[model samples]
Target: MDDWRSQRIFRPVRWRSRYGRAESGKMHGCADLPGRMAMARKAKLGFGDQATTLVARGTRVTGDILFRGSLEVEGEIAGNVTGEAEAGAQVRVLKEGVICGEVRVPVVVISGRVRGDVYAGEQVHLTASAEVEGNVHYALLEVERGARVSGKLMPAAAGSGGDFADDAPTPGMPAAPK
Candidate 1:
């Protein structure tokens, strides 16, 4: 154990209990002293569907990707990402991940940084730590409190291919400035 943690949490020391009695043993050595950590519950990855691809941390990819099922990005990608979402496919970018190009997938969960636009046919969820520098095209969108977007939010019309035209004004917000 590290010196600070050992002395602070586990080391026996002279202290008094809440009953106003002098305790002769460890400080905060009671059961409340953070005993064995409870086993964490298994998370349902990709909305209960297991991911079929993983761009793990410390890795980098420089080409566009085409995938099925689900893709979980924990690293970096510098190209476009297209996923087949017709069968409930999804893409998840974790907190430390980054994507520098466009993304077209069925569902997108972004908790990292995206430097390009995203097109989600089903839904797009941006968590509090997410940051997007390009527009997002989605059928449904969810934005958390601290998510940041530097581009427009365009709703994908029924037959529109999520055009990237700047002149198409989004609803609610005013037209993009020239």
Candidate 2:
């Protein structure tokens, strides 16, 4: 754990609890904190059926990517990504990752480079290593020291009724499940 923290990659804002951990706002230990992760519930399939989720790391994907399940990105994507996670699925962009397009997700933990627009339907987490150079639309946003966002920010657009956007349907804010 000490080595991980010393690497400058284990920053707090870069870490998130899996399985709906953010609702209670309890701080977990590390982004690389290792444990038996809960089994991801198998998502359904079809166009809107919610089957496939993609995570790109150390790779580059051109063109738009549309999926139904959750996506956790740690690489480079050159286009837009549209998907839904079960409340706590995080789209984490590591310091080495670079995204060059629009991102629409429920929760995002950014620690890398984003060259386009970002839309966080639930919350946006910006770590010290994050460098964003475009517009952002988020319901909630958190930025640490050294994090840079050089664009417009639109907050809490869930209730605005625009362009297929809708609020999260959960009764209360989701927290990481124990």
Candidate 3:
């Protein structure tokens, strides 16, 4: 008897977008390049090579945090958050997140409320939902429409060798004397 599996015709698989939308069968096209690049960047940023540490919602952290890879905050951080400058590290603050102290990282993406100074060695992206009450220091800064900043936006000096202390005082702390 002939096997039924041998009689069946193979059909090409169709891919879907992240939201389950059907996509055209074209492998690569100029029309799809931007979306694909954005997806790739998002995936890379969301899930990096190093470990990811999350501060879940409804939680509160009271002390300084020193991390190497990625840190996503959905709750509240009451102190400084620092990351390695050479590790391509990133810090993301969610919409419900709040940081009452300083943030120092290579990359920072904020969609919440930050009440302190932010220092990014590489870039800082402030989404539409982001609200900053203090200054921002970055090599590259992108502020989306509707993002609010109550303080100064300072571009990091070129060839300054990554010193975060030359800017200003930490939130709720005394300024450093010259």
Best by TM-score: 3
- Which structure is stronger by TM-score: 1 or 3? 3
Candidate 2 at residue 145, lDDT? 99
> What are the lDDT figures for the candidates, one per model?
0.82, 0.68, 0.85
- State how far residue 104 of model 3 sits from its true place (Å): 0.7
lDDT of candidate 1 over 79-110, digit per residue (tens) = 99988765567899999999999998889999
Span of ten consecutive residues with least summed lDDT in model 3: 4-13
Candidate 3 lDDT score relative to the true structure: 0.85
Root-mean-square deviation per candidate: 15.3, 20.2, 12.0
- On residues 1-178, what C-alpha lDDT tens digit does candidate 3 reach at each position? 3785564333233567789987653333345668889998878776546878999999999999999888999999999899987777899999999999989998999999999889988889999999999889888899999999998898877786455656766589997442
How does candidate 2 fare on TM-score?
A: 0.56
Q: Could you tell which candidate, 2 or 3, scores higher by lDDT?
A: 3
Residue-wise C-alpha lDDT for candidate 2, range 52-165, written one tens digit per residue = 354556678889876555565677888877655443445778888888887877777889998887877678889999999987778788999999999977776456522225
Say which candidate scores most in lDDT. Answer: 3
TM-scores of the candidates are 0.62, 0.56, 0.65
Who is ahead in TM-score, 1 or 2? 1
Native-to-model Cα distance after best TM-score fit, residue 27 in candidate 1, in Å: 66
